[model samples]
Target: MQNKKRLMRVLGGGALYAATFFFDFDNEILNIAMFLLGYFIIGGDIVWKAVKNILRGQVFDENFLMFIATIGAFAIGDYEEAVGVMLFFQVGELFQSYAVDQSRKSIAGLMDIRPDYANLRRGSEIVKVDPDEVMVGDEIIVKTGEKIPLDAIVIEGESMVDTSSLTGESVPREVTVGSELLSGCVNINGVLTARVTKEFGDSTVSKILDLVENASNKKSNSENFITKFARYYTPGVVILAVLLAVVPPLMYSDQEFTKWLVRALTFLVISCPCALVISIPLSFFGGIGGASKLGVLVKGSNYLEALAQTEIVVFDKTGTLTKGVFNVQEIHSEVMSREELIELTAYAENYSNHPISLSLKRAYGKAIDNAAITNVKELPGHGVQAFVHGKEVLAGNYKLMKKMKIAYFKGEIMGTVVHVAVGGEYVGYIVIADEIKNDAAIAIQDLKTEKVKQTVMLTGDSKSIGEHVAKKLGLDKAYTELLPADKVEKLEELFAKKTEKGKLVFVGDGVNDAPVLARADIGIAMGGVGSDAAIEAADVVIMTDEPSKIATAIRASKKTLSIVKQNIVFALGVKGIVLVLGAMGIANMWTAVFADVGVSVIAILNAMRVLNTQSIHNSTVPAWEGNVEALSNA
Candidate 1:
């Protein structure tokens, strides 16, 4: 409660006790003195401020109205009534302050993610320095357990990087020599030597910080409405109070002039716009915070409002719905065991730079202990050859198998095909493909559950590949063979069909999907670090690559919109009833108290619910890939 309100309450109670002193003076003086002290503490400053502002030609404030009502009560010798009115008015101010702070706390947490220092490297020696001092082309040493200070690539060492803080992906990505790593990722293990490509403030993390800090400058619909409402509401109430004070006495006689004026003062006290001004913003703040906890970062409240209106969710196929990497899955062997085929493939693949080689290595556990190896050779975009365990090994596409006279059997070859040979004799084959993100299915299902009218996937992959993944996840539509530009075309077609009331949300990764991201009503970027295009185009970013965060963000939006509606109804409904009573002179201090503090408490409790999305989903792994390291203990 406001200090003003508490003081008034104590004074009012003391005056009530002093009313018993009218017939007895034995202890009445003490009660009267207590009542006087309470009155001065609560109303004296308000009265003084009103007089100063009136002299300064600003006479429409609540302080001005409060003084008039309390002084009228004093003229009528209703000491307790005067003090009670002051107490309740102050209570409303206290409640408004508490509500606004709670809302600010939500956004404040997101601001905290901005870091203050970067570890710099100087002449083979590592040093701690301010981020602004960082320069381009400088070698920076970001060790295990440290935030990447600038955008750079790994010059040496390997480790699993937990990018969930930036990309929303719970998985730890492996970084080796030549692999690019962005700022803000916590290096989990292994010393990383990075040569900075971008300076400190010019880096990816810096851009994100800059964007978020300025997000509120771009107002959403809801914020604009409250701003306009309060600007008008404050002045309108002041005008009504003036009419109430002057017109009531002129229109009716025989009633005390001070009595009608006191009623007008009470009306002014209950007419504060603080509840609307404070609670509406709180709703959005809580919603944003709630989404962040689920790994979804909303750049601004405008996006939060846009999300609630979303009816269609259009997803980019690669890195959005499906796992972006191609990996080996099944092996068809004629004579050699599956293990032997993969062993031969991995051994020969060690000499190749093709993605097929990487997939084979991943399938073979990347640990070929076989010593009997020699004559290693590789053909780019074709295959690999080597002598593994004293036997000839040839692993490539169907071209190698056809050259060696091998039979091809078909059964679910969704991924790349790697044919194997023992002593140049065709023995087996391996298939590799990019797998779907684990939570894609859950993300689609929850979208439908949340009243999302349509779910679609657009990809540059073949129709067969798109359909196979879509069927498994139950997407409503699939658009395959789309170039990055083609994606924008498709999004426009979808947008043309829907009204502004319903939105089209596009979920994508870095630069590859920026056009579609910008075209959609709400652009969501998955794995946002270093992808300047993604950060620039997207309004909401799932720092991790978790598809489930899309759903978490939607859920938070729905809940926040719901809370805002509840507060609007609550504050307006109570005030509506109280206003009628105050106008008819039937309402008193109790009604004013409820209008201020009671409504504020309800709105505050409703706003805090933005801390959670209320729905959680399970994790998924592809059919063939094995043992993905999700996160390092950090």
Candidate 2:
């Protein structure tokens, strides 16, 4: 629809410009003929819409103003001026179409993330099916080289998965049985059996699609202000133009009415309200486009603007600070050998579904031949009880050790303490700690480098664990033992601490973090493994679960803000010069066209520069200048 509207406008402008030359030969007849053609080609629709709006009691609009201005110009036989007005206004329309198309292209990049269909394996039958048709718990076979259809669990087989499109990482990750696979990740090699865990509509890819498609609904702050400015600016200019035509001639007793009336025509031509109107929205559209190219999906221009104001960034500990993959770092024991302890611990934890259990089993150094295992029982909310080789083995917390009639003397423990009771005697605890995200420290340092004033972490983890993670990351502060509501309180405190010009942003990726994520000034979610609650609540959704993207997002936001300011300054500067020239009766129609169309083109081109995500990390605020003035005096 937009393209078609743009086509008529372009054709109308070209024809009107050409009609001038052919009619220039016969002044009287030519002028009338050209004005008629120009009026019907451009102002006809405006006139119809104005009349229709009047009947509907929605009378005030740009179209009504345009219709009145052109007709008034033609009534005095100023055919050239009337055509020029139509021609330049149409040019502005074309410029707007181009900007809108550029925005659409940027939005299209995000739409590419949604999947079209899936390959389903039902017994011996392999049929092509829509991802929406696949049900939860249905076994879906993902072949080597195909994108995973939906969020699902690996039921069988193992393979290296390529999730660079989803996560920004270049390396392929190995996934085995019981691993949950999200949509948009491609299987690198090996056949894998997956059980669907989420429906297609609720998949991460789907939400991303919905976000991209509906992004335009939420107007950026700049766009909103421009819309309001245009509204008042248009009517104000029209009223002034009417005063110029009527009052000026009446006040000057001997003045020629045509001279003052000509000035009014020039005023109408200059007052098209296209540059500020087009450039502002174009700037936001370009920023949105550019950010998406870097795998950052900004919900609206408002979020982009909000991102630019961020001074404090809060993070969640488990998934956002760390990788959320627990690993058995070190095991301390006096009676058992390293190999014996790991074996017994793995044997005892075989039946548990906890993440720590899997980490211990992985550290066991040997695959569990399930057929050799004997009795296995699970105790919810605590740990697991199992018998290995007629030994009463217990693997749980300190409470579980006491429950099993074993005494556990508290020991100095750094990592998570997984208490063990082998043969009804308290053995030693395995130290299980969630591995920290490699980019955590660098991400924090990068945020500071990007002018982040305060970096904080909120977590439900113990203080010792939170402090250790925050210390490793070099963040400014850390808060621990936070429930969902507690995280919200911490966010509110961060908000209160910020300067009036600053904003507080929170990053979380768990079910417990959802409420705080929603309550934050800006929330960032690691879409992978992040609960639906977190994703739905977050303002900015990072498709990948990488901490580096936080820095990337900040870099993109600051860059976008720079471009937006540049566009606004350039557009207003050009229009201000032209508006002055128009009022003085020195500006020609060609100059007005250049101001309306040429300035818009430059501003739009500048806005498109935001799409280049490369070299985003290369730019810095040049801190040398800040401290160098003191050095010179010294």
Q: Which residue pairs of candidate 2 clash?
A: none
- Residue 227 Cα positional deviation in candidate 2, in Å, after optimal superposition: 2.2
Q: What tens-digit string does per-residue lDDT give for candidate 1 at 1-634?
A: 4545554554664465455446454665665665566677656667789899999987755576577667766666776777766766665555555656656765565444455677777877778888788888888787778888788988888998877666545779999999998877778988898888988777877886786667666666877898898777867987897798788678878666777776676677677655666777778877776666566778888898888888889998878877678776677887978887787778877766677677788878856664667888776556777888778887787776666676655555665677777765668778777767766777787788778899999999878778877777789999998899888888888987777699999998857887778778888988545667666778988766767677778777877888888888888888878877887789875676567666777777777766654543232323323223111100
Error of 2 at 236 (Å): 1.0
For model 1 the local lDDT of residue 15 reads 61
RMSD of 1: 6.7
Worst 10 residues of 2 by lDDT: 625-634
CA shift of 183, model 1, Å:
5.3
Across residues 327-354, which tens digit of lDDT does each residue of candidate 2 receive? 7877767888878888988988877767
What TM-score fits each model?
0.76, 0.84
Best by TM-score: 2
lDDT, candidates in the order shown: 0.73, 0.74
